[model samples]
Target chain A: MKEATTSKIAWGWLALAAVFLVYPLVFQSAFFRDIGVLLLLAAISASAWNIVGGYAGQVSVGHGMFFGVGAYVPLMVFTHLGWPPLLGVPIAIVVVLVLSVIVGMPTFRLQGHYFSMATLAVAELIRLLVGTWDFAGAAIGLSGPAIPRGWWDLTFTSELPYYYIFLGVLATLLLVTWQVQRSRFGYYMRAVKAGERAAKSLGVPVRRTKLFALMLSAAFTSIAGSLYAIKTGFVDPESGFGILVSVQMLIIAALGGAGTLIGPLIGAIILIPLQTATNTWFGGGGSGLTYILYGGIIVLLARFEPGGLVELWNTYAPRRWRSGSHAP
Target chain B: MLLEAKNVAKHFGEFRAVADANLTVAEGDVIGLIGPNGAGKSTFFNCLAGDTEPTAGTILFDGQDVTNASTETHARLGIGRTFQVPATFEDMTILENVMVGAFMRHPGRADARAHAEKIIEMTGLREHAHLRARSLGTPGRKRLEIARVLATGPRLMLLDEALAGLTPGELQQAITLVRRIHETGVTLVIVEHIMEVIMTLTARVLVFNQGHVIASGKPQDVVKDPLVIEAYLGHGHGKRARKRGPAA
Candidate 1:
């Protein structure tokens, strides 16, 4: 039984990997390819957020701070130090690590809603600081310097390179998720999520587990931020550190089914396209309509299927596949 | 010594929950701690288990001072406890619930699962191994709680109201399980309102009233003590004192 389950999971990964590898080849339309890039980035961010939000049950609404830092560090380095955005990747991750710990020291100890609020405040603080700072281009934000397009500089004109880059990023994050799911750390996170007191009693080291999860989450989120900034070549304070970005990540993870390994990817696949389609077709002038439609979908999902689409599928999916996605 | 608490006191705001309570238990001893509803039995247990630090005093476990230790620290130091209310991870399967505890000692998943399986079998939860904990009945939940803690390989186990909601058949089985755990050479401190189980299971009984230990000794002798009778039957002089059972 165990061998069968392991083989099934291996096949699941192989099948998904095969699909992603050939997706760009099969889908020739540049528009669809761009959408694929957006979906992959969203999935990466949401999957990163899931480490803390889904597994540790620490719903953070301030992850945009990490995302913002990820974008700003590389952009600043490129503009000021004349280095590629790739150079800031490690620095952004390190900075976010320290920030997450500082924020998590007090907030991780707080209960659910309060923890979420604390994160929101942290993101807002970063946004306000960046908005006023002249060195980081102030409220206008930093624009990637016009440099020679190359893999080393992480700059490219076509969407295909970015599509593959982000696909690779998503793959790494998914691999991390898979390892965590099968390891002792994954079990501890689930225990903490299920019952903190019970987890503590069982020697799960609740605080430390939460902090570790937050660090891993922040690191991945910063990577996503950097990649997103490089692709766009521009990142304003509002675009980088906005609450909307954090909300979207939260919605993607939760709407997919929080604790499941593939939930975030599934959520991004559905929500990103739906969002783009809605904005293109129904959007008359501004974002109000798009937001209202998005809000309504979120409300409906929360009301009718709080476990999200993955859970809905799990109930009806094959028994062999059902055991592979252990939902919290 | 397995455990010792010196002048331990726990206060929630102005209200004192456990007041200057001192206790000592030798290795491999089954000790019973009994008190009325608000007599601070659970509070004292929490202090010992490191769920809540005492407002004042020191707790020594396995010869290490652990007064300010976190619950995880206590757990790592081989002090395991159960809540008065069943506290299983409702989303996890019965086997997974126990395996979480086993994971503390055994870092490998397969080893933890193997150890947990044995515990589940011993606790008579083998039949329900794959069932989610939320689907369990009262007795099953209670046993599952014990199975989880037992998997932690605790040298000293504190059970708070383990037999609270069991049927007569379930109660007998639970009593046997407790005995089995004790026979494994784990020191035990049990908090039980059921006097019969306490009397049979514990070698010594400590009576608590208003956050203080009023008496401690052999169970039969403690039950016959006039002060214990008053504490249980009330201080008012009554002709019905002799007729009242301690648990009743």
Candidate 2:
């Protein structure tokens, strides 16, 4: 049974990769390409958030701390030392890994609402500190150095290249999330989330599992940040460290389904297009309209479909063709 | 000895919850621990199981000091325990809950599932194995809890009120299940309020009162002790004594 499920998942992943690789070629629209890039980035970031938020049941409101660091670190290194963005990307990931531990040590002690508040405060502190710092360009932010219009620097001249790059990152993140979900660590996290006392009684290391989730989540979000900086060629304290980034990640994860493997990906696919459409239609009122849409969806889903779209699909869809078949 | 606790004490704030509690169990031993509501039976079990740290004394498991190990560490060291109120992963199926424990001993999922299946059959949970654990009735949930702990492959088993909230038939079945568990060479330390269960299943009994061990010996001899009779059986035994004119 386990082997059958694994093979099914492998086939599902293969199908998804094929679609990702061929989508831009067949669609061939600049608007769709831009939307695709944003959706891919959102999916990657939300999937990263899912490790701690969805699996561990530790809602974080400050993932922007890791994301911003991921963006700023690479830009800082590349602009000051003339380092390649590729080299700087891994460095950003490592930095966020360390930062995750730092944040986790202090805030993991606070559960539920307190933990959420602590994360928000930490992100706010980072933003304030960056705004006052000299090297990080204070409130103004930094722009990328000129590259000879190539893929090496991650600074592409067209939307198609950025689209592929973000898609690749999204794919890597999906694979990572899948592997973590099957690993012992993932089981430990789920056990902890289910009930701390029961998990402890069963001999699960609660603190260690939570810290590991935070580290993995931070690392993944940081990589997304690095991509964001490269694609936009700009980073500032506000855009990089805003609360909306955190909220958007949570919304995407929740809108799809928390704890399910592909929920965040599906969430981004649905929400990002809706958000893009709203922004195009309403202009300056787009953000407000998007929030209302998100709120309405959440209310309706919470009232009528508490388990979210994944639950809905599982209820109605054919059993043999569903992704993430391990669920019982 | 499979498990031994020497002078284990636990204090919460200024109150001594468990004071100088001691017990010893060898392989295949089913020891019952009976006490009043506030007599610290749960605290003693918690301290022994490593769910809560003891303020003082030592716990020797399989002849090694494991006084302050974490619960997970204790589990890995071959100690499995169930809670008083049936703690299970509610969202997971009964088989999956057992498999989680089995996975601790066997890393391969297929092997773990096989082990869990065998335990499910033993516990009479085979029919309900695929059902969500929360969907089980009280007796069934208790059985699932026991099965889950048993799947961990523990040499020493600690059961906290595993027989609570069961019908008379269910209680009899649970006693039989405990006997069967002991037959597998696992040492058992059970905390139960049901005197019949203690009398039937336990070879030895430890009676607790006001956070102290009042008596320990063969279940038949110890339950008849004058001090245990006075502290636990209360005035009902006194009325019987009066009616019998002190020595018959």
True-structure lDDT of candidate 2:
0.84
What is candidate 1's TM-score for chain B alone?
Answer: 0.95
Q: Residues A213-312, candidate 1, lDDT per residue (tens digit)? A: 9999999999999999988988989889998889889899988989888889999988899888877776667577656755876898878887788777
In model 2, residue pairs whose N, Cα or C atoms come closer than 3 Å (at least 3 residues apart or on different chains), thus clashing, are A203-B72
Q: Given the true complex, what DockQ would model 2 score? A: 0.43
- What's each prediction's clash count? 0, 1
**Candidate 1 residue pairs in backbone clash:** none
lDDT by residue (B1-248, candidate 1, tens digit) is: 87999999999999998999999999999999997889998899999999998999999997899999999999999999998889999877898899999999999989999999999989999977877888788898899999999999999999999999788888998999999999999999999999989998999998888888888999887887667777888865323555564443
TM-score of 2: 0.91
Candidate 2 per-residue lDDT, tens place, B1-248, comes to 87889999998999998899999888888899998888898999988888889999999998989899888889989888999988888766788788878878777767888999999999999977767776788998889888988888988899999999899999989989989998898888999999898999889999898889989998888766666777776757745644555332
- Number of the top candidate by lDDT? 1
Candidate 1's displacement at residue A123, Å, is: 0.3
